[model samples]
Target: MTPAIYSPDEIARRIALFERIRHPHKLLSEIHRALNIVRAEVNQSRADMVEFAKQNPGMTIKPSPLPLICVIGPSGTAKSHVIKTYYEDVCRTENWQVGRRAVFDFELSVDANKRQFHVDALTALKDPDPEKGNESVLRRRFGKLTDKLGTELGLCDEVQHFIASDTGKRTKSVIDAMKKTLNTGICALGLFGTQKAADIFDASEEFGQRAHIRFDLKGGNPDVADDRALFVAFLKTFKTEIEKMGILISTKTLEDAETIGCLFLQASGRLGLCQRIMKAALRVALESGATTLLPVHFAVAIDRGKLLFGIKENHFASHAEAFAD
Candidate 1:
């Protein structure tokens, strides 16, 4: 799903809906009428820092290195989406327009390594010559380019692959290369990775040290009241949105609290997974020409994500009865 930016009134209406939904179909339509923005501390913090970095070019970079923010979490945790949304929004600001390529977001492939990392970085910066020189020369040129282009911030997603393949220190050198370029006191880094990303950072102590501010989006805990509430809200909004899209859901398992808790557990508290399964279920239902989505459709969706769902089959089996109701 696309990250959404909402108006103040939309935000207010969303909040009201969050408290209680009078009309599932209507609220779902509202959710689709445009994406809504939920103000979280992490989003605001990133926005503020980026804005400040753009406003005062030399102060922060000089006083200390452009701080790095590493968002570590599991797949479907919205790690990249959150930062990507923030970067895209900030880049559209007037301050960011003076230098078109000042901010960028790029994803790393599963096999990305040192050279490829630099190549990708250069490309993300929109550099004309990504392969012009050796590592050292390339880094220097990169620094000069950023200094020239007024580059400020960068986002690198799925950096775990780089860490996983750095057995011979090739990938570690990539960080060293990046540090050299970052000496220009511009272009702070935002790195997104999964739990394995821990090993990536630990592999390069210097890179780990540079990541001063770390934001982690752990899976929502159903045992925790706050987490439970958040999960419920997420589920309700999702259900409403689906209904609004014309898939009449006959399964109250999604609407009930206890049953939904089991679902959250089955999905391992990842909204992305939950959303994906729902979409898949809807697709199956629509394909079959069914007028409504049922528990069986959801079961197939859940089973498709078996290895990743992280739920016990017996426990999930118990929920099947409730899912049918």
Candidate 2:
């Protein structure tokens, strides 16, 4: 494809528009609802502690554990995207102190253990010397930082890494640390990962009991009528979104049933992958100086993304057939 000689400003403007467009998803609402519930519980817990402290000065207060919210999904389900979006929204809406952070999100490393977990948590909290302290000291620092930063939530991403083959001791240590944090009454916890994480949560009676709300992000089944309808509707809505961003899409091709089916197969019915493919398609269309985003642009994007994402097939590619009736 020949590159169009676009001004730097025009390219930036197009990129900004692409970044701003987001497909609305129902799972976002579920996450919001869970956050609201946890927030309410934390606020009440804080208020109760204040009242109790007033009544009994210099007395220790042990608060009950707050409920956890687990966001379980496969890769490309946008678990992190939705959580980060909510975190950004919170940062904007909340009038906290300048240096204080609201949400601390950290992904677990492959060599995840009790010590590394605390180190990662502290790092996410912006602790200046996360690796300098011992495990006990690091855990204490994490708790102190969470309290000081007025953190409302702590998100643990890719938690499956934390669960080792010897789940007895190692898993218990990490789980105990999380339970200790919850017991500290500093911040609510939210876990995000694939189905393996969900299985771990389910297997652990403590985590299972505490995590009453679990949001599962699953891909759509193309054979299912309702699922197919939802996927088609999402594409139509995206057409409107791109048009609003001043990118004209070929209406006839975009609205065609066969084209939509090809899109569904290429995207594997995952919204994250679908959006990524579309963004790549937009870039292809822009570079090619296409007046409108055509099916061929999407096909090229699918082929490119197939290699990038390790997708086995490119349904939109010319060699592939349309969805079978």
Q: What is the lDDT of residue 133 in candidate 1?
A: 74
- Give the TM-score comparing model 2 with the true structure, all chains together: 0.88
Q: lDDT for model 2, on a 0 to 1 scale?
A: 0.76
Please, what are the lDDT tens digits per residue for candidate 1 over residues 79-162? 655654454444455465555565567787667656677777777777788877776666666677766775556677887776
Give lDDT per model, in order: 0.60, 0.76
The TM-scores, one per candidate, come to 0.68, 0.88
Clashes of 1: 0
lDDT of 1 at 36: 16
Superposition-based RMSD of candidate 1 using all C-alpha atoms, in angstroms? 10.2
- Candidate 2 per-residue lDDT over residues 72-110, each given as its tens digit: 888777887877687666556877678787677898877
